[model samples]
Target: MFTSILVPVDGSEHARKALSVACQLARQEGSTLHLLHIPEELSHETTLVWGIGAIAIEASREERENAGKQVISRAAEAAREQGVTEVETVIGQGDPARTILSEAKRRGVDAIVMGSRGLSDLQGFVVGSVSHKVSHTAECTVITVR
Candidate 1:
């Protein structure tokens, strides 16, 4: 049972699925859910959660941060809706994989739950996906939802 679980929210469908899985685990274990969002410029246009609309690759830093806010807020609310009592939301900046690892360690979470793919699927395929990097290096359990 996870005493604390870190979930990286990117406003993707797979992220929503990962959140659902995290919520399920959190409910069963009475875990604290930490939802973290890292705003990064994408190489391609991407759709966000709750129909917030697509974010252009040329979107400015402020625009990306704005979308990140909406994402983290909505994700926290979703956790509450799923019956998770202890929910925390955070926004960080930097490389996705490293930042996620940093947050997990900072929060001392027992697990990191995230989507197998994010907004940069093509880029991920070219390089290694953020989930792949985190899963390979994280100090704790990592659950990647497809």
Candidate 2:
């Protein structure tokens, strides 16, 4: 049985589903849920090209970190709403897969439940999905929710 579960979120619907599943499992197993959010950096050119019609960008590292914090807070709230009171939030920088794996190892989590797709699905296909990397590399069990 899992005693500690890690759930990485990126403000995506898939992540929300994964969080819901993780919450349910944690509640059933009396496990602690760890919610992780990694703030991504987008280049100016990329932002201009892809973010033209998007909402206003927060052009600062502190703003990005604050946004990440808000994301994790909402995720933790969702978990608590699911009746999982024991929740921890983590904000990490760098590669999503590596950060998640390191956090899992650091926290000694028994399992990881995350989304199959994130905010960078296209880039992930060209490179590799974080879920794919973590599933292959993590020492604990990985459940990728679609």
Candidate 3:
């Protein structure tokens, strides 16, 4: 039984399901659930270089943070409802896959649970799935929920 589970939530339906599963496992094992949301990083230089309009850039940043907060908050609330008291919430800013794996390693978590589809449009067309990359690169176990 995993003792420390790290769940990365993105407020998506798929991710919420993963959170539900993680909560159940955590409760059954009497383990801790670490809920993580990787905030989208937006550098001013990148915005200018990409030729994104000022208004659009601001909107993107706001949307990213807003969505991230909602994701973490909802996951935390669900964990509480499932009787998981030992839950931690973390917000990261960077690439989703890399940040999730990094947070898992940093926390020395026993396992990682995340959604198959994240906040990216080209996720499916990538060389490797985010979950696959995390599973392969992480030192611990990774569970990907569809």
* Deviation (Å) of 106 in candidate 3: 0.7
Q: lDDT at 98 for candidate 3?
A: 91
TM-score of each: 0.97, 0.88, 0.81
Per-residue C-alpha lDDT of model 3 across residues 53-83, encoded as one tens digit per residue: 2223355677667656766787798889989
**Global CA lDDT computed for model 2:** 0.83
Clashes of each: 0, 0, 0
What lDDT does each candidate get?
0.94, 0.83, 0.75
- Error (Å) of candidate 2 at residue 63 is 2.0
How does model 1 fare in lDDT? 0.94
lDDT of 2 by residue, 63-119 (tens): 667666777887888788889989999888899999999999999999999999876
Question: Which prediction has more favorable lDDT, 1 or 2?
Answer: 1
Worst 10 residues of 2 by lDDT: 46-55
lDDT, candidate 1, 82-140, per-residue tens? 99999999999899999999999998999999999987788898989999999999999
